[model samples]
Target: MGSSSLSRWLRPEVYPLFAAVGVAVGICGFQLVRNICINPEVRVNKEARAAGILENFTEGERYAEHSLRKFVRNRSPEIMPSINGYFTDPK
Candidate 1:
């Protein structure tokens, strides 16, 4: 079909649908980049403060749930051997 015929056949409402989809996709991409780039450092500093016992804790475990895990994951490039020692050695 020619371009004119295809344009005529498509409904006008389709343009709004396409625009909405584009907006949603843009938002999802922005969040993905922010999480990959930004959230890790924020989480690490907050957790590291607590890890240093500079922050208070409630009547529970010293480390917050997932704090240590996220810290290790974010810093593993520099601290992998020391972190691995936690698993490799019993005491």
Candidate 2:
């Protein structure tokens, strides 16, 4: 209604209720923001961890195959380069 009537209604006791409502809203908004902001990072971190584990699993097989090939090459030192040189020699 009138400014004087509104001013009279706005007593000091109303401030605590307004402050409590503001605090509750702030806490709820903070939780929502945290969920929105932090959830993707958690998912990406989990995917990255899974990828790292997969890489380790595959690399173990790769290293075993590489070592086996190296051992075979050491036992027969005249095959790879000889085959390549014969096939690719310009002269």
Candidate 3:
């Protein structure tokens, strides 16, 4: 098609649609880069390993256990028995 015909077909109303698509594409590209390139490495605590808090078979499980132990340790002592009960008791 001629440039004039194409320009006539692509009206001003479609500019907003193009702008929205461009913004969406830009956001997706930014997130893709952020996830792949700019991701921060998680530093595992040496103390947790020394204390045997992360002795689980898998790395993910070990990290989870270590996080739970750290969470419990940081909380009040009174809450320990209840937290412990949740694991020990059936109900």
The C-alpha TM-scores of every prediction are: 0.35, 0.38, 0.38
Clashes of each: 0, 0, 0
> Candidates 1 and 3: which is better by TM-score?
3
lDDT of 2 at 67: 54
Query: Model 3 over residues 1-91: C-alpha lDDT tens digits?
Result: 6999989768998899989999999999987775554333332456543564433347555534565587778776775788788888996
In model 3, which runs have C-alpha deviations exceeding 4 angstroms? 2-5, 40-91
For model 2, residues 52-85, the per-residue Cα lDDT tens digits are: 4343556455544665577787565656888888
lDDT of 3: 0.66
State residue 62's C-alpha deviation in candidate 1, in Å.
20
Q: Which residue pairs collide, candidate 1?
A: none
